[model samples]
Target chain A: MSRQPRASGYFRTSYQADRALVATRLERAMLVLFVVLLLAFPLFASAFLLDLACQVFLASIGALSLMLLTGYAGQISLGHAGLLAAGAYSVGILFREVNAPFWITLPVAALVGALLGLMFGLPSLRLRGLYLAVSTLALHFVVVHAGAEYETRRGYSTGVIIDPPQIAGLAISDPRAWYVILLAAAAGTLLLCLNLLRSRTGRAFGAINTHETVAAALGIDVARGKLLAFVVSSSLTSLAGALFAYYRGFVSVEAFSLFLTIQYAAMIIIGGLGSLLGALLGAFFVTIFPYLIEWALAALPGAQRRASEFFAVNYAAFGAVMILFLVFEPAGLVGIWRRVQSYFLLWPFRHRPLTGARK
Target chain B: MADLELRRLCLRFGGLSVLEDVSFAVNAGELFALIGPNGAGKTSVLNCVSGLYHGEGAILFRDVEIGGYRPHAVARLGIARTFQHGELFAQMSVLDNLLTGRHARIRTNALAEMFGLPGVRREEARHREAVERIIEFVELERYRHAPVAGLAFGTQKIVGFARALALEPTLIMLDEPSAGLNRDEREDLARFILRIKHELGITMIWIEHDMQMVSDLADRIHVLDYGRTLAEGPAAAVLRDERVIAAYLGRAHARPAAGAAGGGAPGGR
Candidate 1:
């Protein structure tokens, strides 16, 4: 029998192109442009903008972790902020008490975070949906409380101080240098996550999310996959925390809280679950939303003095936006962008339909 | 020869007895059919054999005890099964759904997958080829890139069959393969079942409700009533048996009449 020729357009029929990170040449060019813009941001922006960008990078890492666990694996975790706190606190304590170098303490922090994730993930064997969400919520409160109490106990400390270490005779204490380092790390992590999603483990994760019983029937170890997802997600979040601690030169319990968990959840929701580009989009929206709101409010009369209340207003806006997006665009912003792209791609052929849309 | 033997398999759910002293042996290259009335625990039997449920008995896969093993372990031992409800991954494409069936045969490490190693690439290529062949076998080549959730019920069933076939399984278990199918779909499924046994020489254990299809396609039939094997022999002999006629067929045939008018005797046979 003669085999049919493989289709080779924007979409390739071969397995390699089907599983590629960037499917088309246009996507690759777009990615390169994004990188160049990111690299040039620190040079052109002010110190405040640089700091905001750093926060965005940190939040993006956390959002990426959530995307892997919730979006890809179909597992919900409300306690991820707890895992992040665990990592941040472990790094803080190690550097403060043991005098461990920043680079040396980073891996230890990830390990500790992974251990905590394992402990939390154990419940996943018997729990799912709202039950699992509640369990994780409990975990979040417990970790945040423990961190707050620990901080209070340490004498002469409003927050633990962190000293950045020198790497090969180059000091990393400067904010601009740290920003570059954080940017590199976040970008690498994102690439790693993207690569992972195209792999067997990622496929298994997707399979389990779609149908755990079917995945099990296919010889995918569902339990192991769930646990692995939790571990990887926690490790990434912890790495972000460790970097954030060193960059900020302090470790405060206030930084890691349930509100932060909600924010991360919001990021995944707004970006588009299970899409890497969605996570970055979500991070940008969440990080800049408050600033944008503040700026708009400052433009109004008698609003400059109410700047402190912007946090509450920002939260209200976040809630409103989340509800609006959930109602109108359940697939999030990425879904909308995909629809628009497909609409353009199929232009001039009115009846030709895109494949992914379910009838 | 790949054969499966269920040695006095018993399953109890909490206070309810679902399967009791159920024992059977399916030979290699045989189209063995299990016919039962509603709630006769036919699906439970499939679940027990496929390791979805732990039961008190020995399930021998070519003489190796596979009872109480995890589902993935059972699957790795060359046993594959489909669900009664056609459990296709709704969000994944048809090709992905078929690829999942070849998961047991494609052995690649997480590191290999991460870096797109040569081994992973080769295995992925092999899996894709096998999946494509199965898709062609099921006459679903057109829907290869289609999302399965939006397909017609009959097409979804074909996707399920293609997925099970992608494993190159030694013994494939089909759970109610013709549950919601029309006459044409049922005919297509019957032909596929016969093809699996005749052309590929793959052993099959199927649970089907359509008596006509069972009589035509099954080499042998096992009739179950209230968690026990009521009869076992050739399809003609079992279907014509007195006890099976009294318990299952009589009750099934009388359901429409009873629902038409006033209440009748609860145990109407």
Candidate 2:
């Protein structure tokens, strides 16, 4: 056994091999399979499932932005929902009042979101940790209250309605068509984020997060890096919000509540902080969980009527999952997955001496 | 003008005077050592020089008064420093941490970086080459991709030194570079210090407790006691002074045989 090659397929690497994301042909095939499954999801799933998937995609995008700021840059923000609301409301209002095209409205919304994020992030220079968190929380309330008032004062009888645009004379109003658009946007945002992470600015954010004092001593403008993180995070979140508004064809203050902020934070925590893959995984878990509970209740005898109670229970379950993960698995689901992968990868090696009888 | 000068530097923390009337000058290509017992304000002088603390006197670097400047602003003005306890970015890869040292030199604006403009990419590639050179110089190429937190203490110290070197500053201040290193690591650090002075041609102000290492590496030494400079001269002359011996050996141990009795090591306990 020692002389023979084991099934645990660990490959040695050259310099270039070490840098490759997927080290083996098998891993490359697995990635292809994953993409196929993602594309097939909307087709096979029910209407409720399609809606849930859209929510997951939207939340994933928002969480990705938060992960960049909190996980990589080490600056905690509790006002992300406000930024998202800023994007959604701005896009909704712009498209409704000015009759602007989606392409124009989208970039405008993102720019405004980034500006607001920078404004909120300015307080980070004077505060940090819990103090910064509190200041951002205040920002959330202020933005939400201001948004609520703005929506009321605008006096649009139907609120802001986002009609499907005639893109080259083809209307995109169908739910399936909107799903495809959202999926494309999510993929584009993810690719952009991935590229940023590999770039120098991403590394700077990580350095500032880890040790601002050392970063500054090393000639890094710590304050500027932090502000950039906030701006990027806000812009991404706003983009997601704008997509949400278009898909729903409406904008309301209720959609951007503090609970949504908590939900986004929970997604990042459970998926894994700092890891892009974790953001998507977290969004999946959070979005599907309530639907899963509803389905389970319907399946049980005489339990369908108690669906509202189950929804409440599901929220508590989400909070519990977050707390448990923070205490026991701070690396989140991605960390657990890596550990399991490594265990299988190192099988039959008996690296540790046997200290007890086999189970 | 001196490469770096601190004139009558005074620092107060609430009601306590941590540093008072402290003055020093480091010439170009000079290895100046600052020595003192615990709480004698050795690190305070470095903190003031590095702009980590507010001090009453002017800190002139290359004829520019840099007092009241922020740490990053001071660094941009060509002053680089290493913390007393290896303040490395734990989550960052060794190469990334080194690249951060070159941040002040990165002239690209945010818009350019975000857009991945041609000039920004070229400047980034140039900075990466410099960082790689520093990594090789410090013998940390093996751990170039590893996070600083995962590396050994000695390697982290070297990474800290590499980060300081990456700045290519006119003056470098190191606070206790050999604080937690073993004998072999200390010797390795000593060689690097000499290389930094001889090969790099950069002035350094180091606060160190290892007297023998100081005597071997430093061109001149400054002794501090109770926030005041008690002695300053060549390493050989400072080591032979009675007051220097008394400060390190204490008044009880400052006798004729004190040097021979193994009480000569600076910062004993």
Candidate 3:
């Protein structure tokens, strides 16, 4: 009798069962064990390893935001760096001009990002695909140039110095403190995104992404949904941008380049298009990737003579790895993870019964 | 009073007129058929009614003027339509596609829904039950979780129809539901359409080329040619209208009209 229900794995028999995110006991145990590992990391990790983990956490915020916009909402954007720059600059300008605190500057930056997102998203109502991307790219240049213009006019040609953000009685300059703080922020963002993807908002995004006309016919406001995607994604990205500014204790137009935007985009794509876990996995992959390449290059023969070419070699290796992923694993890391997970989960039973497909 | 009415509806795409002064009324609980050869603006009429096109003149759904409403606004007023080519979410499972039809009715906010709060969970389960009923109604049990994109063309149409039904629409507009269907599928579609009309008392505005099914099911027929209405009346009368006959076959290659052409009810009630 229960064969039809569980067909292959666990079956959802009630509303709660179907709605549960971590349905299985095994999944819950794995999650608890993972949390334990995350908590214990700071105790044993090397300084370099700790810093890399922090960077990956920070990148996950931007990556998740982009995945929400481009992946779920199906809007192409090439202006992500511009939004981040706009955020960082808002902090730079506010702190320099009015001596604003972190509390004041973060919201201001988010507002700037929202306004920029609106500006970036305007072309989307009329343009799609490459044209939309091109317009965003143009706007990115406009935003970056504005930041550069400010730097020159203010005579801070190199960059603007920012004091490490402090609470009423605490200076959070320790890498461990920063790591803990960033971990919370990244976790909060993940929770928020997971909330969005499961709700009516996610459905609207999915609808508009899949087929705008049909979504509209179903009573979804497609234009509004598209704009909201840009606004929300950009705001989160800007918040991350502001945090990055504070973390480095400096704000420079150079840091928010097109390359930074490409790295974030690569995180989402090489991670997986539509999964949040893919965003995190992608951040880890892309963040560690360059170091991995550098390590390999050093281990190879003639390493001493070619030390100057390490940066160049890193770029070539990164590009080659990206192309390999694109050609061979276009579904990104999550797809590979899923295939492996299924292989083990359904061991000895190669194919799922037709009715046993994932919901 | 009609469930839906189009009064002097005119639609133009820049220089070309798609629908010109096309007026028709569909009575509540009636299966009204709109028939014409290619380019008769049959789909345009559906588009106008669904608010995809902002045509000049008025579209009243349940006595409210909806001509200026956006697509979603019109949908909120309980009018649902299937596309000429199935416009299903290609990436979503058939179940998700149908659940989207209930978007306006799903009552949970983002936080509660994401956390799987009890109220939202209950609502989702209830709607899923409703969707499953329609799934069974359409006999799509086998393809329940299949993405609609890779399904056979005819099966896609069934998914489209089922999605439209999941709306609990006041009136459902079907565009070429029988077009790509095999004979058996077409027969099944006809039976479903009729059962919905009689049992559910839902209105239908059908655009179909399958004469046998249309003639058998339609209570009233409206014919169009070159974007203008040729005739509108009970099915048998409209089928025999001389202009309707000429519109199907140009005057240069015309045959004898329907009366001498030997179909029953020619020029009759």
DockQ of each: 0.42, 0.31, 0.40
* Candidate 1 residue-wise lDDT at B88: 89
DockQ of 2: 0.31
Number of the predicted model whose lDDT against the real structure is largest:
3
TM-score of each: 0.91, 0.90, 0.89
Once fitted onto the true fold, the runs of candidate 1 whose alpha carbons sit more than 4 angstroms away are: A1-8, A11-14, A149-156, A348-354, B115-118, B250-269
**Candidate 1 lDDT for residue A231:** 85
On residues A183-283, what C-alpha lDDT tens digit does candidate 1 reach at each position?
88888778778766756687788888988888998888899989988888888888888887888888888888788888999999999987877898898
List the TM values for chain B, per candidate.
0.92, 0.92, 0.91
- lDDT scores of the candidates, listed in order: 0.82, 0.79, 0.83
Which of the two, 1 or 3, has more TM-score? 1
Residues B54-100 of candidate 3: C-alpha lDDT, one tens digit per residue: 99989998888999999998887788889888888877778878888
- In model 2, state the lDDT of residue B46: 79
Fnat for each model: 0.54, 0.38, 0.54
How much lDDT does candidate 2 score?
0.79
List the pairs of residues colliding in candidate 2.
none
Worst 10 residues of 2 chain B by lDDT: B260-269
| Descending-TM-score candidate ranking | 1, 2, 3
Give each prediction's root-mean-square deviation over alpha carbons: 4.3, 5.0, 4.6
